[model samples]
Target: MSVFGGMSKGERNRIKIRVRTAMATQTQVEGRYLGGLATPGDGSPLIDAYRRH
Candidate 1:
């Protein structure tokens, strides 16, 4: 059995929600540091770096 084999459905959903929230917060910060989010056609170096991942 895996380490998380005993976790309930509710517990798993909570974990997923927490992870999604954290990722969204991180993306917002990255966008701010990259000179605000821009369209793909902007062709900015910062946006390029952000889109690399």
Candidate 2:
């Protein structure tokens, strides 16, 4: 069994929530940075890829 198998349900849930929160925060920061890099009226490929998501 994996390490999580030994954890209580509540503990497992808390860990999952923390991980999701971290990922979301990182994505938001990345979005802002990419937006700043993007220009008005037809951006570069990097900006296009970022907005496509």
Candidate 3:
């Protein structure tokens, strides 16, 4: 049973686009954090990522 079975192709494409956009934004933010190039406000995720061992 697929959740998307009732959705139109365009709806599916829009969902995919939104998810891709979110993932790209996340990658950019995380890249900044991991590279130690992030500004002061973006501290929590950077700390968590560094502390994850």
Candidate 4:
């Protein structure tokens, strides 16, 4: 059986909520960096390249 198989429904929901929040925060940070790189005359295409991912 899986490690989390015995967890209650509430426990599982809490874990899922925490994970989703963390992922959202990470994505926001990445998007902020991409926006900074996208500024006029910055001349770095790295952000644009990552934006496609």
TM-score top scorer: 1
Worst 10 residues of 4 by lDDT: 31-40
Candidate 3 C-alpha lDDT tens digits along 1-53 = 36566567769899999987887788788763324345467465344556657
Q: How well does candidate 3 score on lDDT at residue 21?
A: 86
**Positional deviation of residue 11's Cα in model 1 after best superposition, in angstroms:** 0.5
**Residue-wise lDDT of candidate 2 within 1-53, one digit each (tens)?**
56567577769899999987887788788753323454555653544655655
What's each prediction's TM-score? Answer: 0.47, 0.43, 0.43, 0.43
TM-score of 1: 0.47
Q: List the residue pairs that clash in candidate 3.
A: none
Cα deviation at 45, candidate 4, in Å, is 20
Q: Which ten residues in a row have the lowest lDDT in candidate 2?
A: 31-40
Residue-pair clash count for candidate 1: 0
Q: Poorest 10 consecutive residues of model 1 by lDDT?
A: 31-40
Task: Please write out the lDDT profile of model 4 over residues 1-53, one tens digit for every residue.
Answer: 56557567669899999987887787788653323334457664444554645
Cand. 4 TM to true fold: 0.43
Q: Tell me the lDDT of model 2 at 29.
A: 80
Q: For candidate 1, write residues 5-43 as lDDT tens digits.
A: 656766889999998787788878775332445556667
